[model samples]
Structure formats: structure tokens, C-alpha cells
Target: MTDDTETDSDSDSNPNQNESTDKQLISGWHGRYYEDFDVGDVYKHPFGRTVTETDNVWLTNVTMNLNPMHFNEAYAAETEFGERLVDGTFVIALAVGMSVIDVSVNATANLGYDNIRHHNPVFHGDTVFAESEVVSKRELESRDHVGIVETELRAYNQHGDLVLSLERTPMVLKRSHAEPSAAEPPGWPEGIGTQPEDC
Candidate 1:
């Protein structure tokens, strides 16, 4: 069997080297705010998650789903699919989780989900990818620091088959309110919290 794991050579060579360097440390992606969205813009989320039998079984069990088709192999084999099917609700949850980085990482609240539809069955070992398109956005007259943004979310299997789709509305913070410093912890003086001994 081939090992497919990737490694960074620089980090492997001198992991502590970065701590001594004076290079400006830039913040990583915190996701987009309200002004970053535009109607008709499509965001193809970069990550894909492979669903496994364990994933389906565990989620179904935890959620107290009594459906035989999801866990009982013998029962599922007798069904039309002839195999276990991943729970539909798990797929929906996974799809929404996959879209968070691009669609609602900065959202203060998820307004609601609408038009949720499951088009096909998701089976174990199927890798799922998500994409979202900005459907509409509007400023809220009642709130100056936040706005509503609607997006059409879609999920596809490894073979590019659409498995799930839905519309999500999130109340995202406006750029004016999402200041760069807002990423820092509240009420903790910046320099005072760095050393572990300070605690």
C-alpha cells in the first residue's frame, strides 16, 4: 500500500525556527463578512470530506435514529439499494458544515434554512464536496452592524452527483463592525496573556 500523506520539509527540518524569525505574522482566514458577498458570486469550497461506514453508523446511533437501513447490513441488503445508506440528516449537517468557511464563518446568527432537498442517497466511502452561491444580500434597517445574506448551498458526491441542496440565510457582521482587532479575546490585555506564568 502506498502512503499518501503529505509533509512540509521546512517545518520538519526546524520546527522552532519560526519562533525566532522576525517575519510579520499575518492572521489566517477568518471568513468573509457581509460586504464580501455579492449576488451571483459562486464559492467552491476547497475541502472535501469522505464519508465512512463508521461515520454513518455513529451519527445514526447518537441521533437516536431507529432506521434499519442505516445500520443493519442484513436489513439494508434486502432494500432497494442492497446496502447501507448514509443518513440523510447527516449529509445535510455535513453539507452545512462544509459551507461554513465560505458562507457563514463570520455570521452572528443563522437566520434559517429553506428549500432543503435531498436528491440522491449518500453511501459510505463517498467523498462529499460543497459549493455555495450568493443568492441575495440586504442591509437591515434595524441593525447598523449586521446584514442578511442568503446563499444557495449544494453538495456533490465523489462522482459529481448532486446529493443535497438548500438555501441558508445568515446574519453576517458588516466590515465596519468586524474590526481586525475583534479577533482578539475580549478583556484580556494583549501582552499580559502571552506567558503561561501570568495565569
Candidate 2:
């Protein structure tokens, strides 16, 4: 029988130095170069965070939220489905943060979000994971170093069920020698749509 195991330079077999795999597990942005990302690309975030009852209660009260379903357990118990519920805003905020590493680590500003939906209720004990899919990439008309990128975020529970979805647009900096985009002109620029002022 022949042994075919191969050894790497950093492997434990090199006894001169003792090192652990901690460095390997350190999680952060992958820093994928500009040329690497493309439309339709999908990235799943690395970490799953477990929601706690304390988190929900704190967020609900601190935000001065008026939703009874989120805080008052007794009030919720009398409702259609009897249980304490997590705040919708908390779930959205947390889910967006969860996807930041894979979606916006190099972003300049969050342009805006569109079509946000809470597909299901997120419970206190449920664990959440996030994923993003690149929808489009367009060069800013006057900006040389940054481009607008649109992405869709989908948050799921540990059981592989989607609980929320939203689309966001952001300006992402390119890793190049070009100068950063200058601040947009003070007033609304041409060709941009506008809304009527409230009477």
C-alpha cells in the first residue's frame, strides 16, 4: 500500500512552530476585485446570527415603536397567533447588516432600497443567514472611480426558509487609480425625477 497524503508548508507536521487554524477562520470581506463581479452573481454571507428575546425587547422599546405585536406578550397572546413577535424593523436592519460583508464592503453610500418585503415572522430563537444576488452594474455618468451596483438581499432562517427580501442600490468604489467621485452638485441634477412638495 502506498500513502498519498501531501503536506503543506503551514501544516501541523512542521513541528518547529505551533500555530492554530484561527487565522483560517477569521471572517471578513473577500475583497473580490472589480473584474471578478458580474451581473447575476450570487454570494452567501458567512456567519449566521441567532436572534435573542433580549434583542427584540430592547430594540422595540428603544425605537419607541408603537407595534404591540413586537413587545407586549400578553397583547400578542390574545391576537390571532399567540406568541411574542420580533420587530419588523429589527429584522430588516439585522438582515441587511448580515449581507453587508458579501454585498457592500466597498460601497460608498447606500443609494436606497426598493421593494422590501417581510416574507415571514422572525422569532427570537431563530438563526438568520443572508445572501445577495447582483442585479446590475452601471457606471456613473460623471464619476470615474465609482459605479452604481444593485443587489437583492434575501434572509433565511436556519431551516432554509426565506424570511425577508429587499433590493438595494449603492455606489461601490472600484479598486483602481481613478479619483473618487466628487460630491454631486448641490441641487437636483438634470434628468433625475422629482416629487411634488407637500402643501
Candidate 3:
């Protein structure tokens, strides 16, 4: 199979290469460039994360969602679910996050999300698995260096119930002159999004 990314002649493929003299090559694992995606490609993302109590409670507080069923066990046991519910927002966030490495890690910006659905409730301690399918892609006249990609994202519980779904549109960088996205999210300048120092 052909590799989609640029190959650097100076970069070493050997893990044992001299650390000081060798530069790491951009990897497909980090994310895909605009050219790498195709319509109808479905990606079952690799990472699965279990939701913790801290993840639910802290997020519920931070987002100002005071629903008792999420953080209060007493109120939850009386309900149909019979347990503290993991906030739906957290499920959605996790779904989006899971898609990032495969769908948007090299993206310039997330334009928007739509057609969201909460098909089921997620309970704390439930492991969430994510999957995404590329639905569409097109080049933008306004941004010649990038293209728009639309994907349908889904999150499922360990029992295989679909919990969340959404359609996301992102401006993905073209491989022509693109650089890897920042590994650290906080250091991006105000207008320019995070740009990794090395690609």
C-alpha cells in the first residue's frame, strides 16, 4: 500500500537511532490529512475509555448542569435507570474526542456539529467506545490549503447500545503544505489554532 504522507529523507525509521540527530516523522497514528480521507470510510476508533465518577461529577459541575440523576445517587436509584447517569454531554464529548485521532487530528478547525442524538443513557463505570464514518468531503475556495470533511460520530456502551451520535464538519489541512497539529492544546495563539512545532 502507498503511504499518504510526505517522507523526510533526513528522518530515521529506527527507534534506536541517535536521539539528538534524529527527528520523528509525522505518523498516520497522529491523524489523517485531508487527502487521506474518503467518503463512506468507516473508522472504528481504537481507544475505549470507561467513565469515572470524577469525570461525571466534575464535568456536570463545570458545565453548570445540576441534574440530580447525574451526580446524586439517592435521586438516581428511584428512577428507571436505578443508578447515577453519566451526563449525556460527557458521552458526546467522549464521542467527539474518540473521533479526533482518526478524523480531525490534522484539522485546521471544527466548523460545526449537527443532527445530534442521545439514543440511550450512559451510566458511570460504563466503558464508551467510539466510531466514525466519513460522509462527505469537498475543497474550499476560500481556504485553498484545506478542505471540508463531514463525519458521523457515534459512541456506544460496553453492552453495545448506542448512546450518542452527531455529525461534525471540520476544515482539514491538505497534505501539500500542512503541518502536524499541536500536541499541546493550550499554546495556540488567539487567532491561529494550535500548530505543532514539528511535522
Candidate 4:
């Protein structure tokens, strides 16, 4: 005679069963590895960011940009733009930031940027969106587990005008080499102290 019902000891015997259940419970956007990309594939990033007057003024001052067109409304009104123009660097930074979730979330390092061109001026209250196309990819000769992916990034304003464009390269890990455990939150180490006094 034999019992078909699974017992506690039977479940405990297979440690992977628990891990499988945990993986199923934890589900969301995990980002892409090197193998997930293909040349010419374009990704339209999900969110749009609105540039405000405060944003232009703060970034200009924080970076020590002495341009009046970025912060001084009175001075900017005298220029051909007739109003304050958002910092070009700020527009570039925002475009790159928006693409990170779709292109470089799993990347180990950003190789560099190239061919940056600002086509149109950005102003306050303008909403910006970004999209990226995988331009090229190649496996590293020295590092077998790592590969380089180059993408062409483009930014557009609310009216669909091209505001900026650039190409960037990122060093990404291959799916075969990436650590699966990294996807899960780490547990507290046994010997590590949680309280400041214990340290």
C-alpha cells in the first residue's frame, strides 16, 4: 500500500520547489540582457517628462551655467526665442535618463556617446519623450560573458518635433553569464549586525 498525497518531507526534499514558487510570486519588468536585443529593433520608452521653468532654472544654476537664456526670463525675452530656453545639456540628460529603463537597465557600463545633435530648442511646459533603436552589437573579445550594444536615441517634444538625437554604447551581460540570484532580493547575512550599536 502507498499514499499518493504529497507530505511535508516530500516538499522539503526538493529545495528548488520553494525557489520556483518564489520566482512565480515575484513578477514584473526584470529588464533585458544582451541576448534579448537585436539590431534595428526600436523601443518606445513608456513615460513622458514635462520640462518646467523651475527645472530649467534649477539645473542651469546647479551646474554653474552662466547663460542668461536659461534662467533670466527678462534677458531671454530679448533673444530670438522670445522666452527662456531650456538648457541643451538638460534636454540631453533627460532623454538619456528616460531610455535607461528600456535599454540599459541591466548594463554594467556605458561605453560612450557619439553624434549628439540638438535639432530644436526646448521650452518650459514642453513634454519630452524618448525612443531608442538598437544599432549594433558585438561580443567582447577579452570578456566572453560581456557584450557591447550600441543604440541610437531620439527625443521628441509634445508636438512630435525632433528635439535631440545621439548614439550610446553600453556593456551588457549575456543571459548565460548573468546571475539568476540577482533578480531576487538578498537576505540579511547571518553574522551581520542590523543595529548601529551592534556594529
Please name the candidate that would achieve the greatest TM-score relative to the true structure: 1
The number of residue pairs in model 1 that clash at the backbone is 0
Reference-based TM-score of each model: 0.82, 0.73, 0.76, 0.79
Tens digits of lDDT, candidate 4, 98-181: 998888877889999999999999999999999999999999889988899999999999999999999999998887876544
The lDDT ranking, best first, is 1, 4, 3, 2
Candidate 2 Cα errors over 4 Å, as ranges: 1-30, 177-199
Q: What is candidate 1's lDDT per residue for 89-195, written digit by digit as tens?
A: 99999999999988888899999999999999999999999999999999989999999999999999999999999999999988788674532432345554233
lDDT of each: 0.88, 0.76, 0.83, 0.86
Off by over 4 Å in 4: 1-24, 181-199
Error of 3 at 47 (Å): 1.7
Backbone clashes in model 1, listed as residue pairs: none
lDDT of 1: 0.88
What TM-score should be assigned to candidate 2? 0.73
Q: Which stretches of candidate 1 lie over 4 Å from their true place?
A: 1-20, 181-199
Alpha-carbon runs more than 4 Å astray in model 3 = 1-28, 179-199
Model 4 residue 152 distance off true place after TM-score fit, in angstroms: 0.3
Error of 1 at 185 (Å): 8.8
**For candidate 4, which ten residues in a row score worst on lDDT?**
182-191
State which candidate has the highest lDDT.
Answer: 1
Ranking by TM-score: 1, 4, 3, 2
